[model samples]
Target chain A: DTAVSQTPKYLVTQMGNDKSIKCEQNLGHDTMYWYKQDSKKFLKIMFSYNNKELIINETVPNRFSPKSPDKAHLNLHINSLELGDSAVYFCASSQDLRNYGYTFGSGTRLTVV
Target chain B: TQLLEQSPQFLSIQEGENLTVYCNSSSVFSSLQWYRQEPGEGPVLLVTVVTGGEVKKLKRLTFQFGDARKDSSLHITAAQPGDTGLYLCAGDVTGQGGKLIFGQGTELSVKP
Candidate 1:
């Protein structure tokens, strides 16, 4: 069984459109995170949720929002997507990450035309 | 703000060769982790080193955390084609809860 899974492995949308990516972890971890990997393969943290509480919000664009319905699920919603928003989005979960490594899901590749 | 800098962003080597990739940062980290990501897939944790100057070995691979806890290195002995992937180094900021700052990543290509 997959410890973490994300839907819509590939997405292509026209510019100015909105899209959403869903993620869920079955590991029962208390924390979830969203990261974006740019064309240069540089990974950056966008948001971090612990027990469905917002925490560690990086200086990401306001158009990008993260919603954690619960500790097991964290979804990302993008509004007025732009070409620069096209990147691989990854979901990860961990318990007390300072003492552990995160378990990541297969990434969702977003393409904005 | 914290940042991790990875060296030798791209490395291509023969199957039997040995290589080392470095991740450096000026900020101290509570722990360091190494992850390997394949094409179109998420990264899988290879190892995590918490103590400074700690060394851990997994099969043909070895990881070392600098004494200052601001740098780390991954060394592979006799790399194989299957080892070709993107290697990422992430650090856990001392004050950032459950936050990991990642490096730019090192793309390694091992040819048989």
Candidate 2:
């Protein structure tokens, strides 16, 4: 059984197109996060939500926004997607903000042409 | 920004070789974790070291948390082809939440 899952394992779209990546956690975690992995394999935190409330938002561009419809789901929506946005986006969830390890999804690889 | 410095961004060795990957930080962390990610897949947690100077072993892998909690290392023995993947180290800075500050990552390739 998958603890966390994300939709569209691979996404390809044209530059300036709008797209979204959906994530869900079956572990009933209260905190969810989005991380972007660049071509260099550098992983950077983008956003975090605690109990459906925005908590940590890094210096990411406004074009990248994260929405948590519920405690179990966090979605990443990009407006006017650019070629630089092409990277692997990962979704993770934790029981709480209490230092517990996170459970991550398989990841969604987006390619903006 | 709290940064973790990972050395030897790329590693290539033959099977049966031994290697060590490091993650260093100027800022001390409450806890740290290591993960292994394959192509087209997300990262899978390998282990978490909380106490300073703690060491843990899993099969052919060994992990060490620096006495100052500012660095960590992963040593793999008898590297296998299955070990080929991206290794990432993430630090739990405040120890209160899942706010993970990750290193650039080390890509290891094991030749058969």
Candidate 3:
């Protein structure tokens, strides 16, 4: 079974359109994170949730919002996406907030035109 | 801002050749981790080094953490085609609220 799975492996949308990416983890981890990888392959943390509580919120734009309905699911919703939103997004989970045994999903490739 | 600087943004090597990748930072870290990412998949953890001056080996890959806990290195011996991927180093900065600061990453291409 896939430990961490992300829906819509690939997404293509137009500018000003809104989209959402879903992430779920079966690892029973307490902490989950959303990271964005740019064209240069630089990974940056966008948001993090620990047991359904917002823990880390980076300097991302207001258009990006993360919602965690439960401890095992964390979803990212982008409002009025722009061309610069084109990149790969990854979902990851760890047993604790300290980043022990971190596991990442395959990732979703978002292309905003 | 706490940042981990990875050197040699790109590396190409022939099979059986050995190479080393370095990750450095001025800020101290509580722990450090190494991850390898392929073409389409997310990164997979290779190893994690916590204590200062700690060294761990997995098969032909050896990882070392600096004594100051501010830097780390990854050494691969007898490189293979399967070793081709982007190597990333992340550190847990003190008082950052559990956020892992990542390095720029090193892309390795091993030709057989």
Candidate 4:
């Protein structure tokens, strides 16, 4: 079984359009995270939720919002997507928030035209 | 913001060659982790080092954590084409609320 999964493996939308990516983990982890990987392959943490509580909010813009309905799911909604939003978004989960070893999903490739 | 600087952003080598990738930071970390990512996939954990001057081996890969806890290295012996991927190192600082600071990443291409 896939421990972590993200929906819509590929997404293409025009500028100013809004889109959402869904992530789910069956590892029974307490913390889930959203990460953005740019064209340079630099991965940066955008948000993190531990047991449905917002814990880490990086320097991301307000246009991007993360929602965790429960401990098993975390979704990212991008408002008014721009060309800069074109990248791969990865969903990850860890048993501990302080630990660096996380199980990640395959990732959703989002391209804004 | 804490930064983890990785050297030799790109590397290409023939099969059976040995290579080393380094991850450095100015701040100390409680733990350091190494992850390998293939195309169109999220990074998978290779190993995690917590103690200073600690070394861990996973088959052909050897990971080392600096005594100061501010740097780490990954060494592969007789690398094969299966080893080709992006290697990322992440560090966890104290009181950071479980957020890991990632390196810029090293892309390794092993050609047979």
Candidate 5:
């Protein structure tokens, strides 16, 4: 049983298109987050939600939006994707935003042409 | 923004060899964590150290937190091919629920 799972393990699309990645966690965690790993393998946090409320929004662009309908699910929607968006997107969950470690999804590889 | 700097961005070693990865920061953290990630997967937490000068061991891996709470180190003993992956360290500054700052990460390749 996967603790956290993200859909569309692989996504390949063209520029100017919009896309969404879905994530779900069964760890009963109250906080969920979206992270991006660039080609250099640098993991950076993009957004975080606590109990369906936005709490942390890194310096990500407005084109990148995250929505949490509930405590168990958090989805990311990208508008007008560009080549720079090519990277691995990961979904993570924690007991709370202050937890030291978080459970993470396998990750979604997004490639924009 | 809190920053964690990791040294030796890349490491390659033969099976049975030993190595250590270091994560440092000028800021003091309430807690520090270590994670390992395989290709195509998100990072998995290995251990979390909260107290200064604390040390934790997991099988052949040993982790240590600096006394000042500003740095940490991960040492692997007799590393194997299965241990190859990207090692990352994250610092938690929030006392209760805050943000975590991650280091650049160390890519380790253990060849058999």
Candidate 6:
């Protein structure tokens, strides 16, 4: 089975629209993270959850919210998305928060028009 | 501030050519990892180097971590067209649990 999976591989929506991206990890990892890859190919961490508890919340705008129902799932919800929000969103999981490599999902490409 | 800075942001070379990518940081790290990302896919972990001055080899690819744990390098030998992708270096600073940082990444294009 795929280790980590993100739904809606591609998304295109009008500006100001709201959407949610779903992510699931079957690797039984303790920490799950959400990352945003920009047009410049820069990867930035947006949020991190360890066993359903929010740990790292970067300086992202309040429009983006992340919810973790359990240790295996972490979802990202964007409210009134803006044009600058168009980018690829990736979901990742790691057994440890400190020194281990992460397993990342295929990613969801969000395009705002 | 970008804690980790990667050099040679873009590299285009012919098949069978060798290349090296570098990741530098001022802050010390507990562990550093190398990942390769292709279009429409997430970055895949290629190797992890934790010890300072440690070197690891995976076939034609070689990874080295600085002795001070503040820098790292990836060397690919006789690269093939299939090796074209975005190479990223990420690290976890000492005692910072949630502060893992990723370099800007190097876009590698190996022409046939």
DockQ of each: 0.80, 0.67, 0.74, 0.83, 0.67, 0.72
Give the per-residue lDDT of model 4 (tens digit) for A1-113.
89999999999999999999999999889999999999999989999999999998998999999999999999999999999999999999999776658999999999998
After superposition, the stretches of candidate 1 with alpha carbons farther than 4 Å from their true spots are A97-99
Q: What is the lDDT of residue A107 in candidate 6?
A: 97
Q: Against the true structure, candidate 4 has what lDDT?
A: 0.93
lDDT string for model 1 (B36-82, tens) is 99999999999999999999999999999999999999999999999
Candidate 1 docking class: high
Which docking class does model 6 fall in? medium
Question: For each candidate, what is the lDDT?
Answer: 0.93, 0.92, 0.93, 0.93, 0.92, 0.93
Off by over 4 Å in 3: none
Clash list (residue pairs), candidate 4: A97-B98
* Candidate 3 lDDT score at position A31: 93
> Runs in model 2 with CA error above 4 Å?
B95-97
Return the TM-score for candidate 1, rounded to 2 decimals: 0.97
lDDT of 3: 0.93
> B79 in model 2: Cα distance from truth in Å?
1.5
Q: For candidate 5, what's the RMSD?
A: 1.2
Best by DockQ: 4
Q: Compared with the true structure, what per-residue lDDT tens digits does model 2 show for residues B1-112?
A: 7999998799999999999999999999988999999888889999989999999999999999999999999999999999999999999968434689999899999999
Q: Cα deviation of A60 in candidate 3 (Å)?
A: 1.1
lDDT of 6 by residue, A26-77 (tens): 9889999999999998999998898899888888999999999999999999
Interface RMSD of 3: 1.2
True contacts kept of each: 0.85, 0.65, 0.63, 0.87, 0.63, 0.65
- TM, every model: 0.97, 0.95, 0.98, 0.98, 0.96, 0.97
User: RMSD per prediction, one decimal?
Assistant: 1.0, 1.4, 0.8, 0.9, 1.2, 1.1
Residue A57 lDDT, candidate 2, scale 0-100: 85
Once model 3 is optimally superposed onto the true structure by TM-score, how far is the C-alpha of residue A21 displaced, in angstroms? 0.2
Deviation in Å, model 4, residue A77 alpha carbon = 0.9
> Model 3 chain B — which ten-residue stretch has the worst lDDT?
B92-101
